[model samples]
Target: MDPIDPVHGTATLLLIAAAAVVVLLFLIIKVKLHAFIALVLISVVTAVAAGIPIADIPTALTTGFGSTLASVALLVGFGVMLGRLLEVTGGAQVLADTLVNRFGEKRAPLALGVAALIFGLPIFFDAGLVVFLPIILTVARRFGGSLLFYALPAAGAFAAMHALVPPHPGPVAAGTLLGGDIGVILLVNLPIALIAWYVGVYRMSKVLGRRFDVGLPSLLFGEENDGTGSSGDTDTKTQAPPTFGLVLGLLMIPLVLIGFNTVLSTLIESGTIAEGNILVDGLILLGNTPVALLITVLAAIALLGTRGGRTLGETQQLLDSSLGPICSIVLITGAGGMFGGVLQISGIGDALTTSLGGLGIPLLLQAFLIATALRVAQGSATVALTTAAGLIASQAADLSNVQIALLVTAIAAGATVLSHVNDSGFWLVSRFFGMDEQTTLKTWTVMETTLGLSAFAVAAALYPLVS
Candidate 1:
């Protein structure tokens, strides 16, 4: 739908937007409302308050929600399914073990972190952490040291990649709204994520690990099993685990495919390659993000599932299980888009641009600060990233693709910081690593802040250079 003419003056629209955000935070944080419901409710209320006609409210809501899901749902669904296959088939264990063996015991934490960065490409933070739990605990038990040494690096890598990289919902939604090329976002952010992880998470973790000697928790693995060092699954023990090469190869498939699309499209745009050729068209189609991930998932089902002797029915069941956990993530993200849609149609974006434009803050920094505020208020990084992107979509309309990709990176950086009591990931880390609230605040929260800062720093430095 076209943006409705501003029914209210700039001051009034800005106030309505601020009020909507405050209510959103209160509903989610204090009243304990679900993010999806809270977002929808606020979208409607904000629309009416901002003088949107009653007839247009539903259209605004659905337009934003549907558009977001169009880009988000399939990628998230297929990505998680692939992750579940890897997790269940012992792909994660194989990767970690191979890395640790090569890196040696002295570099176990580095090895685990590297494994997580690779494994984390298709997996969400919580699921990846859960899948890697046994491996992390097993290694910690063998080496005997602060759990922080092992846990923080691996966990932080997942956190960084999930926030910064594509195929994860947060960056995907942000990139879509900001008009970024997902492939470019993926390619650019991949190296930046690795650098940020090393400096912000890896180096800092070493210091924190030494300072806090957090003992291993008996939550998942009991005492005796630590000595026996099982892979934590009876099925994995019976079958020959997938080799490290197979696991890495499977993970690389989508990356390579998507890279093909990005490089070809760039060449076509530059007039280096004709766009109408059959082979080029076929390659680009296969390289599309959802299509690439779909191909990967199908390949995984065959190679990791049926080839391993599981029946098709069993494989279907495994893939189906992965979807269940991500439903909330997908829904909340769609709702965030709805909220952003309301803002757009209500003319708040224009008002925001006009208002903030005078402040003389760099757009990159502005994006980061807005995302940081939303993240701290609500505790969902996906919500913060998507909503912030929606709010700034108008301002970003004229930016180069590279700049928009950088904006997504900057927004992601903001959403990643200051994960405290409200963030689910914070509690997950606390309970899994057996740290208390205070200790979690001291370590995990600090590391998240550093990680976010480092990512933003990289994006900020790159922003001026690109344009």
Candidate 2:
């Protein structure tokens, strides 16, 4: 019986992976450890424990870094830079200002919900946080409530896009890996994600806001947000807020390009456009071309600035600032991909996919359970998303491409569950709310669980109806 063989003993490999989670969690939660350092340790632990040679660790790490970073680095780089600018120039502050002032104390959550839903579509979860956190800081100061109230909404908004939207890297890569139709997948999950945002984000934030007070300890606060005041708000005048139109225009470049590519490709395939026509090819280049976000970021830097009424040099500096926050998340996600890559190359994913598929469990449920397990173990949603996507794509070959896309989103939702000590998000919440780890666990973790279960629940109800 080969240990990695699916039929004979593949469960042992999975069990080993499962056990690694417990060990990793202990290191972080019990030891008061750093996640950046911890994730690297876990990657090595997972590989060797599953029987990979210690000598091959370097190769595995490189492979993971190259593959995951190739897809995410650009988007993340742009996100970081853009978020830094938004933070410095008071773009997010503008949104927070309007919402907090208009809604008042009782309805900050609703404002958060709307803000997250709107802003979440364009950027990754953490990027959105870096960009918009000043707003959360402002709201917390005005209302004297938990940062979780606004943070959860912002988190959910980005989560929805990461899980449901196209070209977001996670689902896009998964969809490609599984031969799924990207457009079909987006259309199917779009409405469902919208509903989940309302119930999972809005209602939960409102409840949590009332129940908990949010912000970080004085020491952590001083370290993370400097000169931002005791409540973490540094802006005094609120002079000129960033223009909504400009901010949104900058965000739309990638979306429009990708969408145009999808549509033009469809038309080309249908023979509606002559093959190889310059006009058709130009349109395709606009959207389908690789490095879409890269190009957009450059354009944004050009368009935004003092000459055009964007705070001079703020956009450039903003992008520069986003990189500081990028280190931990990028490395953490890269490590997860490294483990997943080993599973992919080792045929472990194949074995597990086959073994699980035979159980008659719906792919949706299987996605939920797998994501939940890894998330609880490692406490990284990206890790959960990457691992589940890798494993499920192996099994999903037989599924309709549309179904495959939905599965990607479903896995994302599941991995979203149980964010705690090992998860950076938990700390982000804790820092924002000024709560210790324990209370952060009670609220932030629950908000994440709501996102995970509610997303699955929503997808489950819709699966039958759609299928």
Write down the TM-score for model 2.
Answer: 0.69
User: Cα deviation of 170 in candidate 2 (Å)?
Assistant: 6.2
lDDT of 1 by residue, 97-149 (tens): 67678999789999989988986776567655755665676677667779899
Question: Candidate 2: lDDT over CA atoms?
Answer: 0.61
| Candidate 2 residue 355 C-alpha distance from true site, Å | 4.5
Across 309-377, the per-residue lDDT of candidate 2 in tens digits comes to 445455455455446655655665555555455544444544454555566687789887776666655
Q: lDDT of model 1 at residue 451?
A: 95
- How far is 197's C-alpha from truth in model 1 (Å)? 4.2
Provide TM-scores for the models.
Answer: 0.65, 0.69
Tell me the alpha-carbon RMSD of every candidate. 7.0, 6.0
